[model samples]
Target: PRPTQQTQTFIPNTSGGNLPEITSELLNSYIHSSQWHFIKQLAPKITPSLITSALLDLHKNPDLAFQFINHLGFRRIRDIKTRCIAIAVISGLSTSKPTLQLLKETLNSGIATIQVVFNELAVARDELRIRSSTVFDFLLRVCCELKRDDDAFKCFYMMKEKGFVPKIESCNDMLSMFVKLNRPYKAWVLYAEMFRMRIKSSVCTFNIMINLLCKEGKLQKAKDFLGFMESLGIKPNIVTYNTIVHGYCLSGRIEGARLVLNAMKSRGVQPDSYTYGSFVSGMCKEGRLEEASRMLEQMKENGLVPTAVTYNTLIDGYCNKGNLEMAFSFRDEMVKQGIMPTASTYNLLIHELLMERKMVEADDMLKEMGEKGIVPDSITYNILINGYCRCGNAKKAFSLHDEMIHKGMLPDIVMFNALIDGHCTNGNIERAFSLLKEMDRMKVHPDEVTYNTLMHGRCRQGKVEEARRLLDQMKRRGIKPDHISFNPTRLTYNALIQGLCKNQEGDLAEELLREMVSKGITPDDNTYFSLIEGIASVDKAAESSNS
Candidate 1:
């Protein structure tokens, strides 16, 4: 009674309490707040778990939910699990009726964490008994948006476990996921399941599976699947025929592909740009350049515009044939059509120029790549390095190699092999050996080409002992040597044989020659000449000694 009354300070219960009823006004306030901690702290205060009800309410006011998520403060709540669940429910409710704008926003707001929200929904499905088809459909779309096959499969199975029969659209979405994931086996299994469920497979479904099988090089299987579809009274659509034709073309069955093309016309199915593109690509592969060009012109006659891929195929084919002029003409034509050349376009041209020893032009193209904002990839540098090496410019090649390394690009085995071959051919055997050791240190396993190039160089320099040792080393490493490893010019063999014979080891040379013959290698005239000369010299020495 004598002590002064102590004043009690009020501390807000932000950590754990019954959250307030989330009304439109309260939701708006939280969305407009610049500080997410306020929302995060206040979110837990909303009572009776307002997630479902709030989501339903926001479906009527869709813009409010999006606004809340778009706010910087709301993004901070993204890290909180409960807040994330709340947002996922809101997203699921709006998924079916999503505006293009909302889909874009959802994708931009971290797809991975959005997936976690879907997982949480799946886990709590039994407890919540949430049978919102909208939620399931939305999750399927999220999977498509994120291209998450495994997660999408999990969502699909969860939907089934909840006694929700997936519609044909959902099934198609799952099939697409499988295709994107490169799982044709899983895709076919799902397709069969679709048929078992009596859900009519759409033309899109057939197209996806056929394209998937074709891409995997299962042409016969793809064709058989198409035939099976036809047997079921499912007339093959234009896409169905296109996919089969493309598959045939890719498998190098151009004639079969053409037959399919003809059949497409006979069946009153019009071939699209894709069909023509496949035909052109196949023709180009067969070295039928004229036929490929004719197909391109025929595509225009059919009123289908040639895409960049179409032009790239022709350009690549010409480049492969070492016809840079024709490739450039196609490139110019592509530009005239307002189709810009991509990095691949320049890469192909640069590669071709390098193949022709046009280093000066290749270097200019590299500069052009930088100017056009096209960053050179590993292959780009590799082409330039190989070109310089082929032109006997080892110094420039090594400089590029060092530059590539400096730029954090690891030199692949191909690049290393090119350098080694260049040094060896330039009479720098020691340098070549050094590169071989370097390859070992770098864990780049040398292939037959690497060893062969080094061995041939040593033989050329009359270092037969070293060459023979290399051959033995190759055998020890369990690397099978090719014919080039054993076969060289007559001078190389003669030099080695003469050395052996001079050292009274003619028997070994004779044995080697016999072994060569047994291996089906016909000794050249120089080989015979070397052996006869060596024997005659030996006889002369023997006669002089007798006298």
Candidate 2:
């Protein structure tokens, strides 16, 4: 009878109706209410638990919770705990205190929070300052985040003052901070302190010190540190070798850098991207384009993808070698790899083109740069103006000059020299002098090149006395005269000699020639020929008068 009457069970819809309209004030009043039982009961059902978790979770999902916290008027929590929790959460997630501190300081100042935590921790432990390695490690991280070298050293000092022994890892962190900040002197002091304290240093510690030495251009010292590391049974990592290699490159010791690369391979320390990049840059700087290209291929064969910097280095190398076609090809290849060329890339290309006297191409490239939203910098305009001046295109050069001034880009000494040189070369000596006067008026102190060009221009017009006066002015301005500064020209000497012969002053010219010879400058064949001809003519006239 029960089987014949099958009963149907009804499921009630629980989620379809509108949720109870709970205003934020009501929810907050319920959260901080005095009634313990009611507050606990309402918290779970309302927003207290959610808000607390949300506050803590801000560290995990900062972007999502940022607007919510801003709207909720938790400026103090947003400022302090939000950053601390975020860093602590990320530190727990990545297990890298440095990276956590880096991200935390990038987003907010973790300095004050760390100081507060340190003070609280010390008081709780009944110590003058942090004594635990863990606590010191945390403080070291905050120092790194703030990039406060003095504060970092103070933390180390406080650790020692408090009779707390620092761990090797803590010492390494301090050393790394000093190295990164370019305070190798402080790093060395810390290293010696570590040795005195009998705190063992790790491979990372040696690596950081060696890298610091390399950055200071102390390659020989870096090599010695490498030996010390090896003697201590600390094997060098790729980074250690890379730092040495880069140091060698910087010192223009490409051969030494190569030796380090070979040694790294021999030691089974495989070369990484940094290793290859440094090698390539060294080769390029030495004008070994083919070697650099081969290195790029080798890097790719080693399964190391070339980054934008890698490609940019090669592009610069090609540009420097005056191979614009190959440079552009590399640029296209970089674009194919979805890499954008930076302003440096364009500047290098423009410089190369200008050096090759390809003004039209340079102008066109400048226009293309504008269309690409790349504004030309002062160097770019300088290159073009210099090229135009070299080609005797003064109008175009001056037009660019005015345009630069209009754009608020002041002309440096090199630009002024180029324009003055163009005037001298074009035989516009008067105009060149006018520009010199303008340069003085503009408070642009004349450099050696400026004086040299003006002196040479005056000598060319047979204004040797005027040239000498300018030379005196140059001395007054503290500009030293080199051999080139003396206005070298055959016509200038010829005119002076002729004037001396006309005035029966051949003896003076001969004396001047003797002085020149004493100065290690031989008179040209033209000078000798002019002297012989003048003497012979004078003697012939004397013989004729006597006859």
RMSD of each: 8.6, 14.3
lDDT by residue for model 1 over 414-502, one digit each (tens)? 99989998998888989888988877777777766777778778767766677767756765676344322333334434445555554
Worst 10 residues of 1 by lDDT: 1-10
Q: Write the per-residue lDDT of candidate 2 for residues 86-152, one digit (tens) a residue.
A: 3333333334544344334433534354455444334433322213345555666667656777777
**Overall local distance difference test of candidate 2:** 0.68
Residue pairs of candidate 1 with colliding backbone atoms: 19-45, 19-46, 19-47, 20-45, 20-46
**Most accurate candidate by TM-score:** 1
User: Which number leads on lDDT?
Assistant: 1
Candidate 1 Cα misplacement greater than 4 A, ranges: 1-37, 41-88, 96-129, 133-158, 180-182, 216-238, 262-270, 319-332, 335-377, 437-443, 459-547
Against the hidden reference, what TM-scores do the models get?
0.68, 0.61
Model 2 residue 36 CA deviation (Å) reads 26
